[model samples]
Each structure stands twice: as C-alpha cells, then as structure tokens.
Target: MGALQGRIAWVTGAGSGIGQAAAIALAREGATVVLTGRRKEPLQQTAATIKDDGGKAVVRPGDLMKASVVGRIATDIEKAFGRLDILVNNAGLNITERSWRQLKPEGIDLVIEGNLSSAFYCATAVLPMMRRQKGGVLIHTASMAGRVVSPLSGTAYTAAKHAVVAMSHSLNMEECVNGIRSCVVCPGEVATPILDKRPVPVSKEDRAKMVQSEDCGDLIRYVACLPPHVCINEVHITPTWNRGYVAALQQAHVGAGKK
Candidate 1:
C-alpha cells in the first residue's frame, strides 16, 4: 500500500474528479505529486490538500491540448524531480452530442489532441527519462465510453477515448523493453467535478447510483503496489445500476430507427 513512498508522480487533469482524487491518493502513499490542469486555483487546491495531509505536491497549470505545453510539462518535471518514477495521464474532455455531430473541425482537433495525443506526448516525453532510471510506471486514465458508447458522453469523447485505449496498448508493448510498464484505467461514471463541465449538470442523486470515485483511486493505488511484471493491462469499472449502458444505447438505436 505504501509502495509509492518517495516516488514522483505526474497526474494530469488533477484539478478535480478522478484526477484530483487519484493525485491525493498517490500522495498519501508517499508519492510527490505534480498536479496539472487548465485551472490554476483548482490545481492548487488539490496540491494544498495533499500538503495539508503531510504529502508533497506541486501545481502546473496549462491547457494540455497544446502539444508544445505537453513537452514543456515533461521538461519541467525532469528539471524539478531530476528522475521520473510515474506518469498518470488522467486528463480528458467531452462535448454535447449535438456539438459532436456537427463535426466542427476545431472540436474534432481539440478532442483528439487533448484527450488522446496528450497521453502519447507526455508518455513519450517521459519514456527516455524512465528508461534511464531503469524502471517506471505509466498509467493513463481512459473512459468506459472507450469500451462502449453511452448516453453519458458524446461522439467526440468516445472517439478520443478509443484512441486512448489503442495508444495505451501500443505503449505497453513498446515500453516494456525499456523497463516501463504502461496501463490504462477505464472507469465508469464517476461523480466528480468533471460532471460540472458536462453540457448538463449531473445530479448528486443520479451520480451516487454510479461508481464511487474512491474506488477508482484505490485501483490506481493497487496498480502502483503490484510487483514488477504485474502490469494490469486495463481496468473496467462501472456502477452496479449501470450495465453495459444498454438502456442508453437501446434508446439511441431505437430513436435512430424512428428517424
């Protein structure tokens, strides 16, 4: 449980939701956490909580959608920590179903670039450092929407998440040779501030029926605590009330048939 003690971890989207929770969890286990997100206040808030709990943390605020910033964050981590021990690519984004359907070129670019490409960019940036360090952990946060589309998220999100799945799998294969273990975490609907960014505000009662976010953080801790060679390729977590998102899909399919 305490395996992460004294380790250094970089977690994106750390301003809130799974990213925020997971960052604190990692810190509790002895990891010096680097919290990143577009908002400075929220990221610093997360860092403050960790520091209050006798944990180490720093904040790096930026729009991860920028490729240049991705590289810069990695460089900053290298400069600050000297050696990278863990990389948690936990940032993500989604749009309204209608917006996604409109296929605005910029939206397409943003979703793909932010949620998907950023992982590779950050991972690649850290790979050489990890290789030199002899061993490291790479954990990418993906959505269950990547596993299957749902009423909860839109096409842009699903597309971006699918790319994350593909990229993580490839990373697992490619980085193993360098003593780096890569894995993706596919979480079900989590009740966190990410819901606030949704086109619709998901109600607390409704979110409670979904996955408990602490569970997601625990899984990250589990992955981090595993023995060497025990790379859990992926984790699929969801609410008991939700099953394969069958209801949402059934309605979508039936509605399409009506059209």
Candidate 2:
C-alpha cells in the first residue's frame, strides 16, 4: 500500500475530478501531495479529506494562466518539500461560453492559456529539478477529444488537449535521457465538474459512457508506481462504446481518393 512511502507529489486541479482523485490516491500510496487549483476551499477540502484519512497534503490555490502563479506553485513545493518525485498536470479548463466563431481571439486565449499553456508552465517548472535528481514521473491529462473531436466538447478544448499530447511526446523525447518518465493520459469522458464547466450540462446518457474520476485517478497512480525503467508513454482510456470514428473517416477518405 505504501509503494510511494517517501515520494513527493504535486497535483494540479486537485480541488476536484481526476486531480482530486489522483491527489488522494498518491497520499494513499504514501506520498506527500500538494493540491493546487483556482479556489482555496476546494483545495482545503481535498487536503482535509486526505488528512482525515491519515494522508499528508498541502494546498496552493493560484491562477495557472499566470506565469507568476505557476512560478509560485513551484516555489511553494520547493519550500515545503524540497524535491518532487511525481508531478500530475491534471488541471484543465474548457471555456464553453461561446463558439469558436464568436471567440476567435478571447476564447482562443482562454482555452490555450488554461488548458495547454498551464500544463506547459507546470512541466517546465518541474523539469530542471527532476533532471537534477536523475529521475521523476510526470503525467499530463490529455483527452479522448484529442484522439478525435467530440460532439460534446468545443473545438478549442480539443485543440488544446491535442497540444498536450504533442507536448508530452516532445517532452518524452527531450527528457528520457535524464531518467524522467513522461506520460500522456487520454480519457474519453469522466463524471467531473469539467462537464458542468461547459455552457450547458451533459446529458445522463453521455455521462453514463464516461469513465469515473476515481478510475482515472487510480490510472495516474498506476503510472506513478511503474518501475523507474518501465515508462508508460501514453495511456488512453475509453468506454467500450468508443468505436474509432476517426478510423472510419480515414477509410472513407482513402476510398474517395481512389474514386
């Protein structure tokens, strides 16, 4: 149970959803977890719940879109724990208030800034320290939407997620030599507040197809628990219902090309 008895973990978006679940799971495995998000109450609540269960946790609420806060988060970790063993870049925001057409500038900024850039900032913040230590595990939450556009999510959300996938691949190639294990986790759907962050609520039928937050949370821990040499490059979680529509599209395109 204490596979990670001495590892230090930093989990963004821990106030809820996969981040929350991942934070608690890390603690369950014996890591001191730092929970970060925009709101303090939720972070505190998550920390409290973990502490109540005999897990060590801390909270650092900040706006990830701001580089300053991102730096602060890194500093906070350094101040509190000195070195980090695991990093879960699970914080993401989907701005569904307006369509891409309506939000050509503002919406683009919000989506890229919140989802993609935030992950970039956090990863960059930790890389130097991890490289110096000679080993660390970093997990970034992408999405099935990146695998293919979803009817339920916006274009910007999908683009930013795809960026995460690309970023992770690039980081894997860049940092593997330093004993850093990087992974991109693509989940189909989860019953998290992220759905509510949309302009409208997702239907019950769609929610049923979602992988639970706890499932993804445990998946994060599984990635974290892997042996130093065993690197899980990318883990994609999808409901059995997710037939490869993108594959079908490719097949159709080839058929058309022949015609």
| Model 1 residue 164 distance off true place after TM-score fit, in angstroms | 0.5
RMSD to truth, every model: 3.7, 4.1
Candidate 1 has what TM-score? 0.89
- Where does model 2 exceed 4 Å of error? 241-259
lDDT of 2 by residue, 77-115 (tens): 887777989999999988765565656787788888989
Residue-wise C-alpha lDDT for candidate 1, range 162-259, written one tens digit per residue: 88988888877887887788888988888876677677777878888888767887788778767767788888888887744667789999999999
Candidate number with greatest TM-score: 2
* TM-score of model 2 vs. true structure: 0.90
Clashing pairs in 2: none
- Go through the candidates in order and give each one's C-alpha lDDT: 0.83, 0.88
